[model samples]
Target: MYPFLRLAKEFYVHRNDPALPLTGTHVSHHLCWPWDLDLWMELNNGRTLTLLDLGRLPLARRVGLIAVMKSQGWGLTMAGVSVRYRRRVRMFDRFHTRSRCIGWDERFIYIEQGMWRGGECCNHALYRAAVTDANGIVTPDRVMRAMGLDVASPPLPGWVSAWIEAEAKRPWPPMAE
Candidate 1:
């Protein structure tokens, strides 16, 4: 089951957090509940992806993206992601997530996030996200302008740029065996 209750709790808990600049980081804490585990008794990779929402949505809310989307009839969607897992998170383990928008290009926004425990990173992810309307994807420039920022996006980091290039070369719909 999706952790709707936990997501609601996250929203309620951070409801009054101060607004953030577009590139500012949002940090939220979490626990590795038993249900979040896999057969190996560590955090499930799939659940880790879902738990990330607990941080990303709040980050969007703090940066005014939620409001912008609401007023403009836009929806947010993930276009792609890359995650790296490095440590075990057993049941009852406590950790925190840090999320931020690294930058954007003509069509997509790039976000970076990480899960940490005991001062070490357990996992990290990079997400390519898009803002869409009924017509189609809304350009990042338009999204920025709607949020009242006319500034140019900071340069995307080299690694993120490389990832984008690599994705472009990947076959769409994948090849059949």
Candidate 2:
């Protein structure tokens, strides 16, 4: 069993738009590694807290998020992510992230996530995920069971089909003739 699966109870759901930065403005730089101020605000809650520094919080929170579907027996693996930024964020700012399930198929699940500041949407993103096993292996049936998703049969989305086909044709080396 995953330790995070147990620690998930520590985090409570917070719903409220906290103060954030404006569009085209540069706030505190280097607030965290790998991600700059804007990216941080777009992806995080804008608190001084760092996902990495939070120790068990990250895994717990993520596990909690997954638990929603996992309880339904669905396995999830991040497939693709696309983000759009409309504003910046500064120090001492507070905000909220809203996540919702949009759609799903046998092979994939779709989610829409957003970052809000002061009742305005500063950033939005869509995620494509698939179910996997404890070893990070894709097992459609097992994933569905883990997430508790009910379906008479596996469904395939057109986009997912296209992506899979494209990936299958890609050459091992870019310059390979």
CA lDDT of each prediction against the hidden true structure? 0.97, 0.44
Give the per-residue lDDT of model 2 (tens digit) for 1-177: 232422332243211222221111111112222242455344344322232122222222343434544455534456765567686555544555555445555455555555566777766655566656555645445544543544343344576456556755977657855
- Model 1, poorest ten-residue lDDT window? 148-157
Q: Once superposed on the true structure, which residue ranges of model 2 sit more than 4 Å away at CA? A: 1-76, 134-142, 145-177
lDDT of 1: 0.97
Q: What are the per-residue Cα lDDT tens digits for candidate 1 across 1-177?
A: 999999999999999999999999999999999999999999999999999999999999999999999999999999999999999999999999999999999999999999999899999999999999999999999999999999788999999999999999999989888
Best by lDDT: 1
> Residue 134 lDDT in model 2?
56
Model 2 shows how many backbone clashes? 16
RMSD in Å for model 2? 10.2
